[model samples]
Target: MTAPDPAGEAAAALGADRALRAAARHSAGRLTALSVSSVAAAGAALAEPALLGHTLDLLLRQDPAGARWTGWCAAVIAAEVLLDAATARLTGGVDARSTARLRRLGLGRLLRTAPHHAARHSPGELSARLTTHATAAGGVPAAAVSAAVALLPPLGGLVALFLVDVWTALAFLAGLPLLAILLRTFARASGASVSRYQEVQLAMAGRLVEVLAGARTIAAAGTAEREQARVLERLPELGAEGRRTWRIYGATMARTSALMPLLLYVVLGVGGIRLAAGALGVGGLLAAVRYAGLAAGVGAVTGRLAAVVRGRSAARRTAVLFGLPELAQGDARLPEDGPGTLELRGVRVVRAGTVLLHDIDLRVPGGTTAAVVGRSGSGKTTLAAVAGRLTACDGGRVLLDGVPLEDLSAEELRREVGHAFERPALFGEDVAAAIAFGGGPPPGAPAVRAAARAAGADDFVRRLPRGYGTALRDAPVSGGELQRLGLARAFCRAGRLLVLDDAMSSLDTLTAREVERALLRDVRPGTRLVIAHRVSSAARADLVVWLDAGRVRATGTHTELWRDPAYRAVFGDAADPDREAAGRARAEPSSRPDPGAVLPSVPEPPGREAVR
Candidate 1:
C-alpha cells in the first residue's frame, strides 16, 4: 500500500460515517425490531436468576408456592431462548437489506459520474468495495444495535446485585475499570490492524486484476512467472496484518478470561459473609451471587465491539466511491431540424494539472464532416471527447446548434449525440442486439441489417454460426470487426451529431475507404467529427482541423494545408506514399461520388432516426 494521506483518510472517515447512518435509516424498521427483541431477551435473562433463586428459597422453606415459582422460572428461560432466536433472524434481514442498499447507492453514483472519475479505481478494487466492503458496512447497523443492547445485561445485573447486597455489588464494581481498559485498548488496536489488512487486500486484488487483464501479453512475452511474483509481493504484509488483528482479540479475551473468575470469587466470598452475618437470606445470597456473575460478564460485549470496528473500517473504503462527483445535467432540449451545427468556443481541457486541449475554437457546418488530425499526443481524442460531452471542458463552452451542450437534458443530449471509440465495449445478448444497443429503443431487423451493411460488418456477421442471433460470447471478433460493429451501433442510432475517435484505425486501407464512403452515403445526414490518423480520411473531409501540442495549429481544407511540411510530417514517412496519392487524388476529385447525393431513405427507428 502507498503512504496514507492523513487528510484524505480523515475526510473519507467522515463520509463513511454519513453513509453508515444512511444505511441504518434505510433499515430502521427492522433494526428497531431487533433492538426490541434484544432488550426483551436481556429482560428475560435478568429475571430468570431472581425467579429461580426465589423458587429455591420456597422449596427450602417447604412452601406450597415453590412449584408455581419453578414454572415461572422455566417460562422466563423459554422466553429468553425464543427472543434470542428472533433477534438472530432480524439481524440477518437487516444485514441483507442494508448491504443491498449500499451496493445500489454506490453503483448508481458510479454510473452517474464522469467516466474519467470512475476510472480512478481499478476493477478489482471496485469489486472489493462493492462486494466485501459493502457486506462489512452493511452489518454495522445490526452490530451497533447488538453492542448497545449488550450493555443492558451487565448494567441490569449490577443493579440487581446492589438490591440484594451492597457488598456483592461493590466486589463486581471493582473489576469495572480493568474491563473498560481492556475494551478500549482492543478497539484502538483492532481498528488500526483491520484497516491495514483491508488496504493490503485491496492492493493485492488490484494487482491480480491488472495481471489478469494483461495475461495474454505476459504469456506471449514469457514473463508470466515475473508477473505472478509481482502480484503476490504484498502477501506477507497481508498475513502480518491479519495475525495482528487476531492477536489483539486473543489477548483481550485472555485477560477477560483471567479476570472474570477472580471477581466472581470475590463476590461469592462477600455474599457468603453477608449470609453468615444474617444480613441476607439463603435465597437473597443465591440471587446476589448470580447477579454478580452477570455484572462481571461485561467482557461479552468485546466481540460485538470488535465487529463494529471491522465494519466501520470497511465502510471507509466503500465510502470513497460516494465522493465521486456526478456530472450535472440540465432540462433544455435541442431545436427541431437545426442541421446539427457544432461549435467549440474557447474550449480548454485540463487533467492532473496538464493541459490536454487549450484555446480550441472550431465550427462544423450543418450536414458536413470535419476531420481532426494531429500527432499521437496532440489532443485529437480530447477534442472529440469534449465535442461529445464525454468529459466537460475545464474552460469555455461547446454548443450543438446554438445551445450550450451542458444546457441539454441528459436524454436529449444522448439521443442527439452519438460516439464510437476505437475499442467499443459491446453489451447485449447477440450480435444484432449489440448493434441495435444505443440511447433509443432497439431498432427493427431491417434497420439493424442496414447499419451492419453500412459499417461493412454484414458479411462477417452473416458467417457466424447463428448469424445476427449469435451470442456475443460465442462470436469471437477480430479488432477490425469489433471496430465495424462499434460503428454499426453508432449508425443504428444516427443522430444530429456523430463523433468517431479513430474508429477506423483498425481496418485495412480498402475496408477503411469503403466504410468512409458508406458513412456519408448510407448514414443519416449530420455533422461528423472524425479524429483521424490517416491521410485519406483528412483528404475526404470538407474541412480539416490540425491540432499541435494542445492548440489548433491550422484550419482549412486538406489540399489547402498540404503545402506545410510540418503538416505533412504529422503522418510520418510510413504514410508518405498514401499522403502523396491522397493529395493528387483530392486535387482531381471529380471521380468520387457527388458530396450532395442523397440515398433512398430507410424507415426511421422509433425515438431516433435510422441509417438510410
Candidate 2:
C-alpha cells in the first residue's frame, strides 16, 4: 500500500480550520456578547469571596457598616447570576445562527456540485454532516469564547491570593505545574477519542440510511435481520468509543478532583501559619483559602476545553461538504431563439481510473430526436448526462447552439436544458407544483395540465382525490406513474434541449408509446437525447447512436443499424414485439414495408384532448 500523504492531511486539516473560522464569523456579534458576559461573570465570581469575607470581619467587630457590605455582596452575587444567564442566552443565539450558516453553506455546495461529484457522499452521510455535524460545528464559536473566558477566574484568583498573603499565594503557585499537566493530557486524549467516536457515528448513520432506502427490498428478500446486523455492524465500536471518551473525561476529572483540594488545603495550611504569626487576619485567611480553591478549579476549564475539542473534530466532518468542487457557471447567456443544436467533440468521462465514456463525437441538430442505445454499462446514460451538461466532460467540450456548455450562466443553462431521469425525484408541495417545478417562473395551471396530458398523466391525476392539488405524499403513485410525472415535469420546461435518461423504463409499452407520440406532437419541440433500452424507442427516434463499451460504435437510423445482427443483439430479448414484426417483414422483402418505417399510430388515450 502507498504511504499516506502528510502534506495532503495537513492541508485538509487547515481547510477544516478555515471552515470553522468562517462559521464562527457568521455569528461574530453574538459570540462577542457571550464572551463579554462570560468575562463579567467570572469577574463577579472572583470578587464574591473577598466581599463576603470583609462583611464577616466587619460583623465580628460590631461595625455598623457590615450591613452595607452584606448588601454589596448580595448585589455582586446577583450580577454574577444575571451575567451567566445572559451568557447562556447569547450562547444559544450564536449556536443557532452559526449552525444555520454552516448548514446553508454545506447545502448550497451540495446542490451546486455536479451530480456525480455530489454522489460521492451517501444520502445518510450527507444528512449526518448537515445536521449533527453542523450543530457541533456551530457550537464552536460559543465554546471557544467560553473556554477563553474560563481562564479569567483562575488567573484572577491567583492574583487575588497574592494580595491576601504572599505565603498562601506561593503555596498555590507550587501546584500550578500539576494542573497544567492534567489539562494538557486531558485535551490530547479526549480529542483523539472524540474524533474516533464521531467517525463511528458517521459510519453507522451512513449504513442506516442505506438500509432505509432499501428497506422494501430487504423485507421482500426476508433479509431484514441480516440487513439490521449489517447496519449495526459498528455498534460495538461506537460503544467502545463512547466508553473511551467518558473514561478519559472521568479520569481527568478524578485527577483534577484529587489535586484541587490538596492545593486548597496547602494554601489553607499556609494561611493558618501566617495567622499564628500575626501576619494574617481571619478574614484575610478566609479570602486566601477561597482564592486558592478558585485558582485550582481546573475541572471547569477541562470541561470547556473538551467542548472546544469535540466541536473542532465535528467541524472537520462538516467541512467536507464545503470542499466539493462546485459546477461553475460562466456569465454568458445563449443567443435569442437559437436552435438547441448540441455538439460533443471528443467528450470523455472517467471515474476511479476507469473510463465511462471516451472520445465521443456527436451532433444533433435542433428540432430532432436522437436515441442513445447501448447494452448495460455502454455509456448511454453518460452521453445523455453530457448532452445537457449534467456532468462535465473530462476530456473535451460540449456546446449548445454554438456556445460551450461551461460558458453559459447557471440560469441560462438550466433554462435552456432539462432532464428526466429513470427514477426522477419529485419535489414540491403537491402534484401540480411538482409538475411545474423547473428553472425560471413556474408554469401556470393551464400549462401544467397540458404538459401532464402530453405525458399521459392527466387521466390518473384527475382521478385522484384532490386531482392536481393533491399532496405528493398523499398521491400513492406507482413507478410508472412517477415516471410520467417526471416526464411531465421535463415536458413543462422542454427548452432548447431535453435529456431523458431511460425516463420511461418503468412505463408499460402502451403508455410509453403514447407518451412518445405526445412528446413528438404536443410538447414544445426541441432537441431530445433519449437514452433507450427498448427497440421501439430507438426506432421512433430520428437518429440512433449505438455505444459499445465506452466508445461510439455506430450512428444512423435505427432501421439502418437493424440490419446488423450485433446492433440487434443490444436489445436482446427485451426488443419490442413490433420491432420483431418489422424484422420479419424485412426478412421477406417483397411482402411488407421497410423495417425502419415508423410503426402505425395507436388511438390517443381517452380524455387526452380535455387537457389540451
Candidate 3:
C-alpha cells in the first residue's frame, strides 16, 4: 500500500495511455456523447463562413439566396449552442461520478489490505489520493474527448479552404509544423512539472496531517514554529513545480498567439491576390479569410492538452491505490467442534532484508492463555500477529484448529479469530455501537452489555451523559477507558482464538485482573495469545514464551522461568531485593503459587527449558 515507484508512475503517465484507457472504460458513454456533440458543433461552426460568404454573394448579385442562406446560418448557430450545452452537462456528470467511484475504490482497497501493508500508507497520502488526485483524474475523459474533437475544426477548415482556393489552404498548412512542435514541447515539460507538483503536494499534505494529529504534543512541548517548519519543508518544491507548470502553459500560449496571426495574415494576403487576379470571387476571398482564422486558432486544443496532462499525472497516483495487492483468502471452513489450537511451523518474517521473526516454532493448546514476553523489538508482537493470522509469515505454516489459517475463507477467519490492539480505532455513533462493531451475527443488546461489563467498561459507560447512548466522539474518556472499549468490541465477537497484543497496557493492576477473570469465565472457551510487557501478566498466564532477538529463548510456566537471570532481566529485575518486592506486589490471595514462593521443583526439559 506504499506509494509506487516514481519511474513506474512516470511511465504510466508519460503518454496517459493507461489512464485514458481506464477513463474510457468507466465513462466511455459520457465521453462518446461529448465527442459526438463536439463533432456536430464543429461541423456547424465550419458551415458558418461558407454560408455567410454565399449570403454576401447573393446580396451583391441581388439574388434570393441571401435570405435562405442567412436563415440556414442562424439554424446552424442554434444547433451548435444546444450541442455545447449537452457537452457541458455530460462532462460535469462524468467528473462527479468518476471521482466518487475512485474514492470508494481507494478506501475499499485500503481497508481490505493487511494491517502491516496498510500501515505503509499515511492518512494524509490516502486522503490526497481519495480527494485531490481523484478529482483531477476525473477530467481525463472530457479532456481526451475534447482534444480528439478539437482537430475536426482545423481539419474541416483546411478542406473548405482547399475547395475554395489551393494557395490559401497550402499557406495555412505550412504553419502547422511549428504549432505541433510548440505543443509537443509544452506537453513534455508540463507533464513532468505536473507530476513533480503532485508529489511535493502529497508530501506537504502528509506532514500537515501528522502535525495536526499530534497538535497536543506540539503545544505541550511549545514547538509550534518548529513543527510548522518541518511540515512546510517541501513547500518550496511544490511552489517551484506549480510555477513551472504555469510557465510552460504561458509560453505555449504565447508562442501560439504570436504564430496564429502571422499564419492567418499570410493566408489572407494570398486570398486577396487570388481575388484581384480574377482567380477567386469576393465571396470566395471572405470565406478563405474566415477559414484561415479557424485553421490557425490553436487555443482550444492547447487547453485540452493541458487538461490531459494534469489529469494523467493525477490518475497515475490514483492508480497506485487501485493496483495494491489484496491478501489472499480461501473458501474452506473450520470444523464445528474443532479445538482452537494454534501452531506455527518454521515461521519467518523478513522485511527489507531484515528478519523480524526467524524459524519460530511454537504452539498453544486450546483453552489456555499463552503470554509472549520479550524486550522491545524482540518480535513478540510479530508472533502475536502471525498467530492471529493478521499477517502471514514469509516461510511458515500456521494452523488454527488443524486448518491452515490461509485456507479459511475471509468470513470464516474473521469469525473464528479476534484481536484487540493497544490503540484501537473506535468510531461509532454511540458507546454501545462502538463496542459492537465487528463481524459475526450482530450482538444483541444483552450481549453488548455483557461484553462491556466483561471488559470492565460498564462503570464508565454508566457515568457518561447518555450512558450507553453517549456518542464516542462527544465522550471525553481516558486512555484506559478507550482501551477497555476496544477490548469490549473484540469480546463481542465469539471468535475461537483471541489475540490481545498489549491490549491492557494502560489498565491498572486491579482492573486488568478483573477483565482477565471476566474473559476466562464469560467468553466461550478458546485459545488466547497475550503479548505482554509486564511480569504480572506473564505470571497470570498459563504458559510464558520468552523471545530474544527474533528467536524463542525459553518457554515454560512463569514460576519455572523466573529462576533464569535472563528471564528476570526482561522485566528489568536484577537484584534479589527488587525481585522480592515485585514478587510481593504480584502475589495476591489466590490458589496459584506466589511469585516469591518456593514451589516444588518440576522436571525441566534438557534443551533451552521448553515446556511445549
Q: Could you say which candidate leads in lDDT?
A: 1
For model 1, the superposed segments whose C-alpha errors exceed 4 Å read: 1-4, 574-577, 589-611
Q: Which ten residues in a row have the lowest lDDT in candidate 3?
A: 603-612
Candidate 2 lDDT score at position 326? 86
Against the true structure, what is each candidate's TM-score? 0.93, 0.93, 0.90
Could you give candidate 2's per-residue lDDT for residues 337-388 as a string of tens digits?
A: 8767788888889987899998887777776678889899988888888888
- Best-to-worst TM-score order: 2, 1, 3
TM-score of 2: 0.93
Q: Which ten residues in a row have the lowest lDDT in candidate 1?
A: 597-606
Candidate 3 Cα misplacement greater than 4 A, ranges: 1-20, 574-612
Give each prediction's root-mean-square deviation over alpha carbons.
4.5, 4.7, 5.4
Per-model clash counts, in order, read 0, 0, 0
Give the lDDT ranking, best first: 1, 2, 3
As for lDDT, the candidate ahead, 1 or 3, is: 1
Between candidates 1 and 2, name the one with more favorable lDDT.
1
Tens-place lDDT digits, model 3, residues 99-192: 7766677677777777787777778988898899889888887777788888887878888999989998998899899899999999999988
- Residue pair clashes in candidate 2: none
